[model samples]
Target chain A: MKKLVNNPVNVVEEMVEGYVRAHPDYIKQLQSNDRALVNARETKENKVGILIGGGSGHEPGFLGYVGEGMADGVAVGNIFASPSPDPILEVTKAIDKGAGVVYLYGNYAGDVMNFGMAAEMADLEEDIKVGMALATDDVASAPKEEKDKRRGIAGEFFIYKAAGAAADFGYDLEEVVRIAKKANQNTRSMGVGTSPCYLPQTGEPSFEIGDNEMEIGLGHHGEPGIEKGPLETADKIADRLVNDILADIEITKGEEVAVLVNGLGSTPKMDLYIVYRRVEQILSERGIKIYRSYVGDYITSLEMGGCSVTLMKLDKELTDTIDHPVNCPMFVQK
Target chain B: MKKLVNNPVNVVEEMVEGYVRAHPDYIKQLQSNDRALVNARETKENKVGILIGGGSGHEPGFLGYVGEGMADGVAVGNIFASPSPDPILEVTKAIDKGAGVVYLYGNYAGDVMNFGMAAEMADLEEDIKVGMALATDDVASAPKEEKDKRRGIAGEFFIYKAAGAAADFGYDLEEVVRIAKKANQNTRSMGVGTSPCYLPQTGEPSFEIGDNEMEIGLGHHGEPGIEKGPLETADKIADRLVNDILADIEITKGEEVAVLVNGLGSTPKMDLYIVYRRVEQILSERGIKIYRSYVGDYITSLEMGGCSVTLMKLDKELTDTIDHPVNCPMFVQK
Candidate 1:
């Protein structure tokens, strides 16, 4: 595959540099380091800081949300790789205000281990208060009893928005962490892939699927899904994803929920919305009140052909936070 | 190729519906019609309404900017097809706050003609003043003397931001139109493609290229590009795109500009930022001031494998407006 890059090893560093340079008005590098934080021109005065960190490949996740009313700081790792404890510590310290920092990130094992270490470092070295919330939304990774074993997917949006809002509303670290955990617990997601993505350094797919077949519950790293089957219609595919997710989460009738129909990477908006239409209709038929919906490529798996659906049961607080005004290059809500 | 759509003809309409539903806080349908408008709660407050429209396939164009401090309404057409005059008229009427409306759209012939008709209709029937500006940024299309022949590509973002700011500053229809036209004139874009995207309805690619080859100056609709050659590095590709755009527009040293490194659907963020790194280096070496930079799949061509670079020479007003705060689902600036 043809790629626009210098040395493969430099791709991640170069990308982080360029991204920070582009959005300097909203983001800044952490004291000569690769870690970044939202400019936070007005953040220091009003609330606790919200921190999110993850691998670099998920563009909008770890970086795109670093702006007003979202994450205060984002520690980026290498492409699909975890950031070391140093950068995480740097980010944690940079965004730390007097109140404390809430560390929210996807539930990858590397991220969990690294962020945990960074939290310890922050508490010991900087005398900063910090708490962590793990996103475990992908239902295909584990049964409901093993929810913590599931991998995180697009549902990280809910955790960030809720936690960010809680912090914005002057919640302390414990309160902010509680809200984030609640959001993560109520969120559920499942994904299916028609193809795999080629990692930039290797130039080979992490996993593979047949041209005419799709694998359900695929991880972002191109790991195999729960099952493989011939390509199906939008409705059938939506059922597979939605059924798996709904079965795992206990969303009651008339319960308000926020739905995110996310394109993995290469899926077109047309197909993504088609899947959303079916998913919406099914939810409506079940008397679920969709508080809001998000349909786009928010979280992606490079150029893989697939999408995931994330449903978050919402209360007034979660809804208000999700609707909070934000201004970032990749996402905005007014 | 496998697709998830219910019907090809319904793809655009269904997608628009899904978008509106997802962003009801910011966008709404034009009185049950296909067109959409930002829910300007204070429409009676006499703000100059900004309206943009075009075909549907370009995901973030037209629809993505409908929010605070951006476009007030968007009239969408079928996929890669222009919207008829009625929908444009509807959007214009819905957004008209008795302070005049600025019609901003791409330079496609159909859009120009349709929006022109709608502007006339609005003037005659609603006593709402209207002015139009066309975005013509594709460098390969034509030269300055023949500016009307140039195609509009990803550089439309500059025009949108400028127009939105002008409207926010309470510029009349004529003044807003003039400024928007100036922004378009100062902007130029060039794109290259490694693959063509298949239209959902046709289930066939709109164009063709060899596996080991790429085409430059490709349109968003899978139209033929200017040149075909062997695949090259992202840096080499960025050099070609930036050099062609800068040369065509005659961007001189020390001039401030905004850069957009846009991915055409299937390209990954890592690759897009890699290109941006090279692009920034080239511009910096030339002593050009990059006031702003955007990197992502803003204006996509379905799932085509490619990227485009857009450069807009920025005046102070344009720069301020491009940097202004905006709130929408797809774009946020804070």
Candidate 2:
């Protein structure tokens, strides 16, 4: 795999430099650290600061959400790898206003451990209040009784939008955490992979599937899925994902929800909409109200060929916050 | 390749339905047509109304730019195909206040023809004034003397930002056209393809390349490229693309430039940053001031394996607009 980098180790640093340089109007890198904050010009002192951290590769998640009415700070890890506690601590400190800071991120093991450590460090160093919420939306990783064990997926968008709005609406740290956790609890996701992806440093696929086969419920780290079968039609594929997710979440009929048909990386928009069409039909038949729908690559696994479906049941608070305005290079509300 | 669409013919309409439903607070579909406008709440009578339009599949382009300080209206077409003239005319009329309207779009045959026809129709029907500018930034499309024949790539972002700023600053239609054209003149892009894309309708690749080979200077529509050779190192790829673009645009030493490392569709960030790493080194060595840089899948070709580099020489006015604040669902300038 021919790559355009100098040294493999420098790829992350250089990429971060370029990202900061590109969006100086919205975000800036903390001094010599792998953490970024919304430009101070746009930071509000009274608003709860929302911070998200995770390994890189999920472009629009951790970093793309940093701007007005979204995330205030983002700490980035190396590709598919966790950032150290120092950067996480730095970001938490930088964004902490008088109100407090909310650390919203996926439920990966490394992320949970590192962010927990960073939260402790920040609590000791400053008078800033801190809270954390884990996004565990993927249904394949856990059973209903073990929902907290599921990995996060593209449903993070809803969590961020809701938590960001809560903060924007002058919610305290605990309030923001409560709302964010509620959004996560109501969200469910499932993914299927048609092709594998290669890690840059390894230059080898993280997982493998046959050319004519696909793996459903694949993890972001390319872990094995629960089901491997022949490539199926979009309708069938959507049915499998929706069935599994609906069964896991046990969404009642006529409930309102937001749907996200996310491309893992290499799936085309046409394909995503195809899956969405089936998803919409299935949900509509169940008398569900789709409050909103998003179709594209929100969270990806490098360039893997796959798509995931995320459904989030919306309450008045989630709906209001999800509709709140966000200004970022990669996302907007209005 | 497997896809998620029900039928290729209905993909665009279905996706548009989902988009408008998802972002009703930010956008609305124009009266049963395939056109969309920024929410009426965001409009002001005296503000210069900026409009953009093009084919679909380029997810964040024409549609994504609609919001405050960006496009006021967007007309969309089928995948990799231009919108019909009626939608373009509808969007123009819908966005045109007493203030003039600016038609900003890529330089594609279908887009130019359709938008041109619509502009003329608008002039014939109402007293509203309108002006159009074509984005021609792909340096690989033609020689210096034939630069006008170049295809627009990711540099459309710069043009959109500049044009949006011009309109935001209350520039008249003619003045907005002038600045947008100037930005296009100062921009250049070049791309490489590891694989070709299949049109959903056709269900076959638009073009083909060998597994070990890549095509350089490929266009967004899967057009034939300037050169085809075995895939090489990421640094070598970046060197080739940057060198060709800089030479084509006659980038001078000490000039300030904004760089965009854009993924065509399926190229991963791991690969994108690898390319950016080398691109930065080459630009730095030339003493060129990189005022800003962007790396992502901006303008895509379905799920193609390729990437493009765009360089725009920045002057005060262009930089100011590029730095100007924008609040939209997909693009936010803080």
Candidate 3:
């Protein structure tokens, strides 16, 4: 109830309206479906469309990436709830270039079911070829042996960056899907939550956390984590997250990778860098080269206090794509 | 306190160490003084040095801007306290390329005193020319007739951008100071705090408010604002802030201005955009044209829940400079 929203029921719509208003030249609501957002500048002719969609509350994730160099469109759902087939289809239609459209989203059960249905419906009724690429980069969500079963976390940012660059480069839908999958496979993330976030509809937190405890591996939508334990120092927390991510990857001592330290909602950027300090130390000691590093709230749960560390074990292609220039409202890297 | 720090007493130094670790390619600790941060890449020969410094709690504010297209160096201070004269002098010495150095920071007493003393000392002892440019853009901090008495808020971002661009373009010290002053003169801002942020050392909020109330015009470091009242709708809060800023500036019809809707620490990015929605609408209705808009956490108190609106009435020079590409770790516009 402490949130700075109008009516709780109207948070999503207002957020969408405000976002488009704030970035008037960059994004707009789909004429056919207000829940679907598309870049104001139309997708280039004959280029593969890059569409990313997911539940709301993760600002700058699915919607904020809609721009010239990133996602062409996004279908927004209610808070932490998947978009229905309607919005997804609308977005697919809005951003579909002659080459077809590719769908990129987090690997949550609800999202997978919804986006999958949308893709099927688009192909059957609308004659649009929709390719699907799910992000499965959260190392703690599943054992390494079951990597495909892991839910996506902060690594979704890297996937979107790489895939968007590929699509913008005029890659075919299959090629775009390949790069998306490759990016996801090369990425791994793990986080520890020190606070809980409330669902706006219920105005209550889905789970309880102690004043001095931390929830390791909690999902963006309050999913279960490894365990709740007494809060530890920044160095120890960084060790835990970095170790979890390294265990799930095949990074060699001399390999180069991109490091991302992401803050979940209320964690200060200052603290994220503190965590990044340890991440850098461990990687350096292990002889791993950090090709580039990003530290910020790239993706977030609404006001949930914690941080996630993501590493993309990069190949030349992935690194090139990540270094590709982007001009989105939330993130613009040159 | 639920902060992810090693020791509260060591927060500033650790943060400095961590920031350099996180962005080793963009910034480094000064060899003369660890508290001073200099751009890893040296400034172009003879370009006027742009040195920004302030209290430590405002991450990304005074330090994050130190890079190729922004500040040349920064002096880091203890949490919520001005950096001592030593670090300021060290930073000035590190970045001075023989042209001159300019100081850009918020209008705070401690910072003003310390920086002014450093400037004096540098001129007399080190023979370095240092110029001062204060940011006074917070409308709520003082009445329109007493605008110079106001404190600086998020408007400091625009000041830095304009002044940094001027300096980077090889403007003389006087021209850089002129641009910085003009940007400050044309800027206006107001904010509302929904929750208080604690000082890490004290582990207590500097102030308090009821759960249902908010502090209008609250300063970044918990300074007193216009009033404390019941928390209003996002639209109402935006209207209040916008009206206050407009009342203090001569923003006529057909004039272009850049708008910044900044979140103070714990305010979710979603709420910030919701507020921006109304800010844009109000500006449109008043016939004021928006040249560009930025909505994010630019200047923040550590985990304080609030949002501030800033307007920088723009001219062709300011607009061109704003659009100029700058590569900084936290902010990049291309």
- Judging by lDDT against the true structure, name the best candidate: 3
Q: Candidate 2, residues B1-334: lDDT per residue as tens digits?
A: 7666666677777767656655567788777575555554555776667888788888777686788778898888877888888888887777887787888888899988998888888888876688888888988887889978878888898898899888888887788889999999998889998887777778788788886788998888888899999888778999999999877767778889988898887887656866877788899899988887777777787788878888889988889887888866556556
lDDT of 1 at A109: 86
TM-scores of all predicted structures: 0.93, 0.86, 0.98
In what order do the candidates fall by TM-score, top score first? 3, 1, 2
**Residue A90 lDDT, candidate 2, scale 0-100:** 81
Candidate 3 lDDT, A1-334, residue by residue in tens = 4677888899899889989988888999988889988999998888888889888888778788889778999999899889988999998888887888999999888899999999998899889998888899888898998988999888999989998999988899999999999999899999999988877778898578998999999998888899899999999999998988887787999999999999888888878888888899999999999999999889898888999999999889998898888999898888
lDDT per residue (tens digit) for residues B1-334 in model 3: 5888777788888778878987788989988899999989987789999999898777778788888778999998888888999999999988889999999988889989999999999999999999889999999888888878889889999999998999978899999999999999999999899888878788999678897899998999999988999989989998899998887788999999999999888888888888888999999999999888899889889898989999999999898778867888888877
**Candidate 3 colliding pairs, count:** 0
**Top candidate by TM-score:** 3
DockQ of each: 0.59, 0.40, 0.74
Q: Which is the winner by DockQ between candidate 1 and candidate 2?
A: 1
Name the runs in model 2 displaced over 4 angstroms: A1-9, A24-51, A67-75, A89-102, A116-130, A165-173, A250-255, A277-287, A324-334, B30-51, B72-75, B90-102, B116-130, B250-255, B277-287, B327-329
Candidate 1 residues B274-298, lDDT tens each? 7888899899999999988889877
Error of 2 at B172 (Å): 3.2
How does chain A of every candidate compare to the true chain A by TM-score?
A: 0.97, 0.96, 0.98
iRMSD computed for candidate 1: 1.8
Worst 10 residues of 2 chain A by lDDT: A34-43
lDDT of 1 by residue, A15-46 (tens): 87777767667777776476555554636743
